[model samples]
Target: MLLGAERGAGCYAARVLAKRIIPCLDVHNGRTTRGQQFGRAEHGELRDVGDPVALALRYDEGGADELVFYDITATAEGRGAMLDIITQVAERCFMPLTVGGGVRTLADFRALFLAGADKVSINSGAVANPEVVRAAAEHYGSQAVVFSIDAKKRPDASGWEVYVAGGRKATGLDLLEWAVRGQELGAGEIVLNSIDADGMKTGYDLEATRAVARAVDIPVIASGGAGNALHMRDVLLYGEADAALAAGIFHSGQTTVGEVKRLLAAAGVHVRLVQHATLGW
Candidate 1:
């Protein structure tokens, strides 16, 4: 049971476990990159930020609860994630690491675990073969598997639709139904990335997030459109997410994990605060 309150009726409440703030690294060709709403970079150059390993170290020291690395182009290119980078980041960053992209089989899960990933995220692969989620969970324990859903709002404004292959292909599956199915298949957690809200920085698609959180039993991590600490707070509290994952805001030096934590803590939300000696803010 989490540290705070229990889930009640319409009023969404907090769980005692401190909400996690994760910094996402979307890697392409072994380099970290960021684009608006998953767009291609200007010209032929990727938006190279810094070395993934180096950035992981900074975030780890700076007090990120966990790190999520996505080999953004792996699925599109029909290749696996760059294991070398995963291994390097795993070796250096002490916090929990979740590695995604190209996790198509139980073997891929084993390989990532052996490479030091604490959790393996499955997106397209799981959509293509739902049993893979069950098989991995049975073999590696549910805690080791995270079902990642990239969802976009439907054309008729009915509900969210699932997208795969890095948000390029639509699965035509209902978002709430898929999340419940993932939970039934033994996924330990759900990562809901709203394609409509991604990179928009307007706010999280609270409607979609709240719906999935209410539908599933597992913890939900809301990804995309995190502009500031307020957005993080809203997702965790009102949106009912267990954690909030953001890329551009953290990658562009707009905010730090510690800063977000302090704000969350001050807002009467449970969050781990990093020692001031390191943050200096």
Candidate 2:
């Protein structure tokens, strides 16, 4: 278990901060759900899992380093982060929580912080005005700001293009260019979520992740497409990502945070120690 001094306001630990495991909870219509490839459900409809708070508690028990609560429909619907859910989860879970989806202005960031969010993530908002990244990072410090980029491979397979508004709107921004811009604008970290690989559970897009990781000086969190421990290991080591984020695999009980961390540790990767982990637990 994590000690009192260890669980601070910041999401990352002092030492093993970059190499960490994060679990994402995507909520649609107030219920936690999972789908393939950014809203495309392979089975025709999304699998409504359960309450997000319940899932957060379960992931917390599995020893996730950080938890991300994304209101999947908030931005598309033109609203704000789910304060009710954030407050509820913050009241219970001790781990760092990042809330995103529909965060537009500085006031939105303030409200999220007041509700006990450790970090505020902005996707469409940042794309709309890159200056917001600088403003938020300056006001709250880069540590509290997470710039999330949803990218899809172009039709010509030349490179990836950034997407926003629930992956329905294309911004025509190059992945590497925007990643560098986000860092230049003072983003503490960048979450590179692949539209093509999301929820596929095959593995992360290593080439894209490595590119973004190398492009930005800040920590790059590789999101989307996590199947098993080896897949995560490949991304963290080979992909050169500072961290890995997953949703479907863990939500479906195919794996747990502890399981992934154990594998990474056994492979000589640095990860926060969890209870019962052989590597220093």
Best by lDDT: 2
lDDT of each: 0.84, 0.85
TM-score of each: 0.91, 0.92
| Deviation (Å) of 179 in candidate 2 | 0.4
Clashing pairs in model 1, backbone N/Cα/C closer than 3 A: 3-16, 3-17, 4-15, 4-16
lDDT of 1 by residue, 1-281 (tens): 21101111111222226788999998987788876666654345357887888889989999988889999878888898778887787767667788999989988887887777878899999999999999988877777789999999988999999999988899989999999999999988899998888888998988899999999888899998898879999999989999999988887889889889888988898877767477885
lDDT of 2 by residue, 188-223 (tens): 889999989988888999999999988878888999
Candidate 2 TM-score over all chains jointly: 0.92
Model 2 lDDT-worst window of ten: 1-10
Number of clashing pairs, model 2?
A: 0
